[model samples]
Target: MSQWFQYDRRIFKYFNYLLVIQIIPLLAISSYLINEINPLLFKKQMLYYGIGAIAFLVTTFIPWRKLIWWFAPLFYTMNLLLLLAVDLVGKTILGAQRWIEIPGTGLTMQPSEFVKVSVIMMLAYLISKKPPLEQGYGLVGFIKLSLVILIPFLLIAKEPDLGTALVLLITGYGILFVIGINWKIWLVLAVAVGLSAPVLFSHLHDYQKKRITDFLGQPSYPVHQALIAIGSGGVEGKDKDEATQTQLKFLPISSIDFIFAYLGERLGFHGMVTVIILYILLILHLFYIAIRN
Candidate 1:
């Protein structure tokens, strides 16, 4: 018992506890929403949460700074190869081939997600070696970094997982913004992207185009129902049966995509504001830590 007490795995040193805490509201809200949808799913989500906690603990055990430089390149190379393999042999669901089945696990995984992690790691490794100049990265430096970002962005977008691709692109650029990019370079890129918008729109996949069309043409049935759910809540929420949008199941995927709407319908305007405040606090805490360190 004494030995166990003396042995510190340094759990507290591993991750930002406040960051972990910040996620609790989202987890609680998700679990509650799933419970409302089906009690079994809530239980499954709890089990997944437990598994995720174990995964997080395991990840913290890694000697990230020491091995990340060596591994990031290898990991990124493999990520790109897997993405290429997906293009040829990936399993298609809906209309996109973005997943590969794990051999014998009967489980599927998206390679695009792996690309995102590897890119972040790889960028950190790259940038730390050659920190940005005072004015920011020059022309040559900018292209090198852009290549690192754009390769995976284009590959993932080709998988037609445009949403995830865009997210990864934004995250990479957001990091650049923090690290500092030449103001002139940013301006030039912005103008180029703006000019290319029409051409890019023309190249979008049919379903992707249809999604945009649907957004412009008519509100989706789900969106319309979600609006009703939000509008009905007013200042204070109604009783369970009186929450017709959720209770009558008019608000589709209330537990997932339209969860904000479900939250409003069940808890009212105040609850929504409270959740928003918590998220804002979390963001401020992250910014505080960033600045302090």
Candidate 2:
């Protein structure tokens, strides 16, 4: 019992309470906005928060430094296997086969989401084992790391989840960039991607291509409604019942993807600015923590 207390003290000694504080407001706002839209979803969101809190507490007790060497690779492989399983027996929703349904439960899980964290941990573990040199990683080292990212990118893209795949690809490469990469390799990559752009575009699903075209041409229906919601909010926003855009269901998925639109409608320009500022501060604080560590 005493040893446990000492371990807890040691963990708390370096805990970044400010980071938790920053996140609380965002979570609270999200819950409030979601509740306003759908009570059922709000309840599920709260349940998720509870589960996350439990996960956080459990992770606090883990000796990550000791276990990460093996655990990171194991976790990455498991997630990859799950991604592969999605192709075999995955559930489809909204035209994307990115979920695996749990047996005897009406709940589905997305391996792609878990893969994001695993990939980061795997990269960290690998990088710690073999760091870059003064001029950065050479061609051989670069290809090895690139494969770690590309394999998952291909799998997720095959699921037709291009957005998430691109995000993972960018994030993985961005981390490598920060760690250091040979300039020649980057130049070659740039040229290669440019040359492959046409082939990549051709391979995109029709809806995905249409989405790109819509972005370049004009705003889609949802985007248009989101804009209207923001514009209507003006400087001071409206009351809960008065935010007609979201209240009347004009803004699609107002509680989920378009929550920001609802926020704008409810709080107006000042509210939006405040949320943006908070997010900026949180991001800057994260960077500070990363650099310090």
Q: List TM-scores for all candidates, in order.
A: 0.82, 0.92
Clashing pairs in 1: none
For model 1, how big is the CA root-mean-square deviation? 4.1
The lowest-lDDT stretch of 10 consecutive residues in candidate 2 is: 1-10
Cα lDDT tens digits for candidate 2, 1-39: 433322345678988899999999988888888898898
Error of 1 at 279 (Å): 1.4
On lDDT, the leading prediction is 2
Candidate 2: give its CA RMSD in angstroms: 2.4
